[model samples]
Target: MDSRLAQHLLRRLRHQAGADAIDRATGAGLLTERRFRVAGRGVRTFVPGPLAAGRSEAEIARILERHAFAGSIARDDLPGDNDPAAVPEQSAGHDRSKSLDANGLLRAVRRSAEPLGAADVAAMLLLARSITMNTMPLGEILEALRLPAPIMTITGRVAGFEKTFLDLLEQGLVLPGKVASGEGHILSRDYDIRFSHVSDARWRVVVFAGTELDPEERERTARQVSLAAQSRYPILGVSEDEDRLPAVLRQAAGINLVSGPLDLGIIRDTMRAVLGQVPEGDIPHDHASALTLADLALAIRSGTSAKRALAVLDDLARIRMALAAENENDDGAASGKDSGRKETGSKTGKNSGRGNPGSGSERIEPAVPTGTETDRFIPRVETLSGYGKAGDWALDLKEDLALWRAGSLHWEDMSTKLLLSGPPGTGKTTFAKALCNTLRVPLIATSVATWLEPGYLGDVLIRMSATFAEAEAAKPAILFVDEIDGINTRGSAGEWTTYWDQIVNRLLELLDGSARSDGVVIIGATNNPDRIDKALLRSGRLERHIVIPKPDTEALVGILRHHLKGDLDAVIATAPERETGRTDTATADSTEADTASIATGEPAAAAPRRNEPAE
Candidate 1:
């Protein structure tokens, strides 16, 4: 049995068999569990299990049939493989023995008779996970489906996703604000089950989208999301920029249903659903558009005939793609021309130090040198020492990053932001760079000192905001903010009360600023934790505080080894000789001094030998 065939069998069984029958088969040794390891963790998947071990395809089919899983089971449906043990079980049940209603999950999304395209099915699957995880109430999904022209607006809010919406809109395949009907359209729905106690059974669901909103509007939306969550509503968020949404909104959103590219079939169905008919002539099925069903409805409502809209959209798509290709060509040529200089500069540390942070809206990569002379010699956190818990934390972060990149972990779930407190020589700043190298992400370093270089309160605040904004732009990057204690305590500001309060307040906002700091692993280094604003150290700001200790002798040795690099082997080989020499010198000198003191009828003198200094 192949993995694919095993998956196919599981899929068919879910449709044909009852939960009890499947459970019985599994319990009766007909099925065995296979474990899949991901990021040092094992995930159990139940497939044909032991039944496929020694049986032929026909025999397995018969076994399934006996279990009342299927009728008229065909041998052709079951794939043949000589090695039965080779196929791992498909991922189905976890630790739980019972099956969650797969059919019910299907019906929850497929509210209409129309077939679901890839994007639709993907959306449904994400929504189902949200419901099952108890993050979102299923009733909310139902209600969202009932709404007419739910807004799935196109905008450039998040970095990577901005291009997606922009590209589609420029091609006319996506229309902005079409489904909104002058009101917000949150995907998933709420159903008014007349006096059924349906909504009361679980939690209330609230859905909202602010992808197209301006900064001020998004703030208001964030406030609304926060209020809704405070009111005990389980929010299901639908946005293209899920990561960039306000921390409050993101925290509230149990299920984030991001809109993906729409296939031609879905587009056709949407056109028919909105306009009563699809456009005449062949519609391209090649590329998926970012357009949603609401976009189609809006386009229809905008007075353009379905046929004419389709023609115009297709034409614009061709032109957009052509322009995109041209732009790519230009970018590639420019990159090639600059690659040598950039690489050389990185190696030589010529373009190092705090990079130009005020450089327009373009992504500014902070050029903090990561405690190394050149890029090649920068040691990872694993190679460092004296960081105490911070070192262990960095290792854990490294592992989590691996899991995150592998899609087994989510960003919000990762303990990425932390405050590092230690005296000046404790390598707090160094730990940040080491963590960055260990995680293999870019480093964006800024400090309270740098923020004040511009003098004026307004300019300082702008610099502070820009640093955070830069970090967000270079997502999955390490943002190291040094001298965080410089953002003085609120009440202690005294005469500069207004200035320092504003600065601290701004720092707090940037630390948890949703879209601006999302995806950034923030490391705030401070020499004095007491001086830091209490609110800054509270949960959701820099929640975790790790005090980096001064490197002990062993740590110092390790640091030496790391810096020594090629010289480490030679140093290690001669270490015993040096230790032996020092020991012999101390013993001989102590004996001579004691003998001299005894002969002179005086008390033995304290002899400082080897590495010790004479007092």
Candidate 2:
């Protein structure tokens, strides 16, 4: 072994026992011979194998214990055997020292307070060090250091203050207050500190001992403590006074004040404790008016920036502009026609056709045809009739309409593939027609009974796709499909799924496409949304899931008033009286007489039968 190699082997043996070191040495082929001697306590012995040497005296002693090589080897002894595996044990003490230095534990204590009790200072020091080294934010550090046991113990020990220091912790200024427990004993006193911001650089520390203390004494103490801490640990602190505090502590650690009026000084100190100062720059000031309800609603829906939301409101305003223009045009045309009639010396009637003067005298136009196939279709005004429960149904429809207009609850987008489900004769179909009429848009009302055909699956898909395409081309129109669930229900296997899936897919595609296109809506009315497939309810696709709930009392009353045109007070009063047979004959006779007069178009000659009741 080389002499230097032997020394390295000995240094490696300090952390390992004899057998382990020999195993390592043998594995490395460093040991060729097997002979060694041991001499300690006036005893001499000889063993086998190679001897180990160390770089230092301590390592040499460890190596002797490992191989029982108690006898000393001289520098004259040539290299015996060297193992590649034999490596020195690195210093554990140095690594531990590095960790403590990195944590800045010692520096934190010296900066806190002199004559500070070891335990209290230790707790604060650990907390501050953890915050500084670990990059813990100020809030967390304050919480860890606010533990009552450590704080009170340290304060009592350092300031000779009593346990009443716990009371100081209760004041919200220092920390948040604690709730009292049973028998007037505090269950817990935990302080919560909120950090506004943390500085990027180390802060300068300023300790105020007292005004009476000479300035020289304060400076000496501060410098001595600061230097000692920085030398021992990774952190550094400096002392400062109020006038010089902000500039010195601009971005430094916390300061401890010993003798000033705490509240005012602390507030001013905190105000100066900003992360950094903002640079002066040009600032713009622009003011705008508050939005109206309609504008506000559009703003929320678009979720655009304030300026863009305002732009959307501007677009909606154009709708009102167009309406005003149309009104003005109508007025001008009426005036022009009236002037022409006076010039031509012909009397004008309301029915005068634009080109033909006497066309109205030839024949009367038929009442707007309902349920008839015509090229130019106009919606017929249907008289809504009510049955036992149907009268209350219309009210629900009105409530939903109100909700839609108010935007309290918005309707599905005009392009949404909606499913309006309810029991039959609940006005699902009528409501659909009414919406189309009210909006004055073309309604392509198709029924499942009419659309389904006995044909190939391809034919069905083609027809379904064509329907959506045509609806899209006819922009500003509603493709009102009634009983939609009929064509898309479960249990019809094979071609049914294929056909229905294609239909749903086509509907979703059209809905998505039309959402970007102007003025097309698809209103699908069904009696069973549950029976409809689940894929249609996804967002941005038939996104609105409106459950047309049954009518409540208020809604029912509105429906009755709108359609019946009957005396509500009389109906309500007479309802119970007639049911109980307590209605007087005079009132009953007058009601029957009025009904007969309405029905027959004749004056009533006699009173009604006493037994009969008015409906």
Candidate 3:
């Protein structure tokens, strides 16, 4: 290692283990060193010595376990005797010294709008931190920071730049991530990285937490960690979130390098990185302050038009403002402290609340009506028609719910999330309402478009999250997400890519079984199931896809009877006795056509009461 790299590693070691730890290691000769008299024999500066002459690899490896160092030392940099019993070194995948075209990099930078964005700067911070304070291999960290060619093409077009941003990242940062599976996926979860290395003499385990894992998965992860502790290779604990790991693993984590909240500079740089430039006008400081890196990633996309990016950002800013206000309101409510602002409907719209999709003008309507509304004619799953398999699914859910409520069945065993797909007016919304009645739970009705009504990306996200929160808050509830296909699939490279990407990702997080939505059954209705992001339908989410096909003739007849409250059945039974005159063929044809319209999901006219005779 060069002096600069050695000094860098030393500072990182000091940060991770403390000054005394490094001093103790040096005194023990674990860190290779050479003594030279700078001024005189008495005044000497101890510089990093040639590894070939200093400590053996085993001694260096012992310090790794003793201090619980998270950063890896390049094996080639260490000098070790050909002792077969010594600990094995992990192979650094590729050569870092390979020549990269500085001219090509400079050319890309000059063509780019700005040097970097919040993501790149954050990547730099993450890279530095991972090197200095964590157990992650430097190669792995660089792999995570690497961007795709398209992003490089956009971000590299910097207006004016002199030097390479980071010498360490010069080769790999512009390239795409090569290993995006396993550990790479974990590293890519968030911009802020906080991980620690736990080790014995033989094995190393990098423990971190954040993402939710079920009991079985947790057991599997714990077993993996234990196995890694018995082996030479280091294994990463399955997570990127905090307070979600098993207690045994959590206790063993030694040192972490956590990231702080983003600032205007990072946010601007992120925009520059993704969009090639920041939009004109000042970003709302409050919104910018409240933003997470995920939110920023969701707001910006590579190859996005500057106009769309600006719009998305503006929307995000407003959403943050509204969310901050809403949070304040919630806090006030909790503390019995009154905020002068009386609770109106939502900041985004009038029809926002738990299970309340609002009257007439709202994008979504309440599936299960309340009180007197429930007394009015509304189909229950038992009486509903035309749903076919979806109805059977609902009945099964009702049974499972009964068993669940009786504490005879586990929530994990129940199929909670479902995707209902059919053409418009196939009574998809009605199924949700009927299911709500069948399950006897409140229905929180929402849609992707409804979430966007606030006209800000941030507000839409807040609303989306709020809807899920509302559903979760009301356990034994059904969250009816209508027009779910409106949440565009993540495959599009269009103007609204970031918008849809954020929405889809947020929905995935909410719909995830780990998000504490056990009793909140999610029924996503879409006219176009193919338009949905496939991730949404993955296991543990809306995994079951049931089609609510257009009603058949028999199903239409059942639907008609439902609307008529059995009055139509009475008419059919008594028709043989009363219809002595010849039936009009045209009139009969018209009646059948209207019935087909109802089957096609056309709104049906109000029927006479069961007590009242048909007109």
TM-score to native of every candidate shown: 0.37, 0.27, 0.38
* Candidate number with greatest TM-score: 3
- Whole-model lDDT per candidate: 0.50, 0.36, 0.50
lDDT of 1 by residue, 507-615 (tens): 7656666323346788889989888888987877788998877776557656655676665446545543324445488777766664444333344577886888888
- Candidate 1: give the clashing pairs: 32-49, 140-189, 141-189, 143-189, 143-190, 144-188, 144-189, 144-190, 149-179
- Which residue runs of candidate 3 sit more than 4 Å off their true CA positions? 1-378, 513-516, 566-615
Judge candidate 1 at residue 608 and give its lDDT: 89
For model 3, residues 1-615, the per-residue Cα lDDT tens digits are 112333343333223233334444344343333456656674522333333123333433443443333333444433345643233343633232232233332222123222233344444433332232223344554454342210000011111110122221222232221111122123332232222221222222232222334444665656544543443333333322222445455445332222223334344545654566765443433344455455555667766765676567668777866876798678557555465554554332112432112111112223456677335456788777788888898899899999999999989899888899998888887788777777777777877678777665444554565465455435667888888888778859498787777677767766763334467788888888998888988888889999988898667766775676535445544443323353564455445555545444464444444345657
Alpha-carbon error at 581 in model 2, in Å? 9.7
Q: Is candidate 2 or candidate 3 better by TM-score?
A: 3
Q: After superposition, how far is residue 601 of candidate 3 from its true place, in Å?
A: 20
Residue 10 CA error for candidate 1 (Å)? 46
